[model samples]
Target: MKPSLQLKLSQHLALTPQLQQSIRLLQLSTVELEHELERYLLDNPLLERAEDYALAANAPTTGDGEIAPRSDAPAEPSESASPDEESWLGEEAAYLRQPGSFDEDDDDYHDVQAASISLREHLLSQLGLMTLSGRDQVLVGCLIDALDDDGYLTQALDELAESMPAELDIAAEELQIALIHLQHLDPTGIGARGLQECLALQLQALAPDATRNLALEIVHKHLELLGNHDFQKLKRLTGCDDEALRAAHLLICSLNPRPGAQYSTADIRYIMPDVVVRKLRGQWTVNINSDAFPRLKINSLYAQILARQRGSGLAGQLQEARWLIRNVQQRFDTILRVAQAIVDRQRQFLDHGDVAMRPLVLREIAETLGLHESTISRVTTQKYMATPRGIFELKYFFGSHVSTEAGGACSATAIRALIKQLISAEEPTKPLSDSQISEVLGQQGIVVARRTIAKYREALNIPPVNLRKSI
Candidate 1:
């Protein structure tokens, strides 16, 4: 066979570095974008933050065209300014001069965060003040260490004693004594073995009375019945009247099952919405949050040097810097476009709350904006919108739909909101069951299955009818 060489041309899609960067930045949240920019700023000398340049706007330039260090003193307003304008400018200057102002570089600016102390540290502090011998203190401290963040001693005393050194001669009874001392800490339920014991400990801490005794007995023995809202069984077993049972139930409800939770360090995440939705002139308007948008610009000094020297080593870096700045701006622009589209679609939700939310999906926004579904997904992934109702991730607006009897569709989110409203208005003694809720929706022409009602109810953290019942 003769070998023949022929050239064939075919086109395939490829992502350029700039396009890849734009996609990546579009998917990142506000905090993550800031972190990504910090990495870029550290690696690229031709990139600088716009905030720094603005802060040094009044400073003199050096021979190399770099801005000189700014002085600590505040700049004064011009004397030629009008009296009214001067007064306004003076007030603005005073605000900017205050501690913890918007200026991150201000020496006196410090974020005020509540000091958090862990459960173990709190228990140890209480132990330190107690009049106990060294050995007793060590044993109590060991027990305190074994407690979980919820203040429950999940480990068995026997297991704890066995895990200790044999030479130390620790026993389960000694650990029990230590447990007793540890339970006497400021938080009443600390060192409890289980929910029943935790509640019992809290109940026992209260002064002796008929209600307290009944509540303690209920916690120790009939807790499961109480949890199931089997009020009849509780009454028969505890031999208490409806009024007494209700009072005891109220007392039990006031006790915190997780006493140590107050001290536990919570991982609180803050969201910076990329866009803010507001009702202006009877129209829902979307505006980009200036703080959430990253302000990036190329280093003018390096750019100037590259422009004059034509074949400088920084030319590649200069181009990269320009690409990043443009890409970041494009990222926010795409986000704003997508967000505005979402706000436009969800205007009913903003006006009348979640129950009025219309069914939406990424495809609708993508088609409206002339973008791909994947692009819309990326734009909404971590991007948030601050609205009158609250801050919600853009993805929250898009949900699957349920068909109604009238040939219309209802959003699952709207259905959930309806279920929540119905349950909130239900009588405590006879809370609406899943089937009843489903029927209520059915009567409204929106057919939702009992299982779906249960699912949405659980998602909303509402208990079942059996558990929601009260005396």
Candidate 2:
């Protein structure tokens, strides 16, 4: 080690508190932004919602951007202001003017009735109608609880009986009877022990006919062959011709595999778009949703107090409030700019459909906006744009470039859309294979490999030709 220190000078990036806050705010989604603003309002008294700003004659209005010092004088009504011009906190003020006012249509506060009954509740209600001994009902309820969310009783009757309390005296045979009764409940397949049993339960609920009997046979023995789409094996095993097999296949397809899925407890997510795109005078326009961003402003009263008490620990709070406001404004401004650039590039997609989408990359928008590619990625993530067609994520506009024969690049999104269109119009008996799709695209002057087509087809959820083919 050298005893003497050598002079070294280097420059490296440093993220200041303000810069860090700005970067964090830039990455937040609409809901997250609102929560962050709420936190700022709670933490910093100098910051308030924009709707909370109320001006009076007695309160000094600084036109030079300097905060006024606090005075003993009380605020007086402005002569020029209307007699009924109320503050945002006023209860009787119009909601449009009072941004902090509670929304009557807000489902978060109001109790929304359950859309549908739970599987247990549905089964219990049906059980109430049936004349059963309380002991039997208890056994049925235990079996109902044992059934998984997919309406399949995964546990065996003996296993279920063993898991129960010894005082209940529920035998395996009695539990089996209870399960049979439970299976008869609405949704038709509630308590079946397996897939075959579930399908058989559903078949039994249907009217007795040749199609129903054929479906029963297919489900009972050839369910595996049917699942594998091995029509030839099903025909050999069931001794059914193509016509009968097709009818039975259609019947099986019509049945619900997971009968209890209708009662799933998962919450349905609601998306609120950040940007709205529309056409005016035949020119596409992008508008940032003001409602999605919280309305914030510096509290003039607190600002004045802080001005009087400068360098008394309030300066940092004031600076923080200012930084938050600036960062929030910059965040939305950057989002709007990025969204506008995207709309300009994806105008064809808006005009037509996904098929018209041009190849787009994050670099282009980042360069156009004079921002880093990572910044563009952050802007696109968790941000949605509402267009005339439907709402889409900002990232939906960006896709890998696929070159056409004419030396032009097409978006993978557009190619996928094209593949979907071709498959939708394909003959069921002779569905287009991935190679055939690539050939069709080549015919249209778009050069795409069979494997690429297959990848795109799988992404679109279009099954392979064998799986897609109907008898």
Residue-wise lDDT of candidate 2 within 9-56, one digit each (tens)? 999999999999999999998888888788888988877775433321
| Model 1 ranges with Cα > 4 A deviation | 5-9, 52-116
Candidate achieving the largest TM-score: 1
lDDT of each: 0.81, 0.78
Candidate 2 has its poorest 10 consecutive residues by lDDT at 87-96
RMSD of 2: 8.5
Model 2 residue runs over 4 Å out of place are: 52-114
**lDDT by residue (tens digit), candidate 1, 138-193:** 99999988888788999999999999999999989988898999989989988999
TM-score of each: 0.86, 0.85
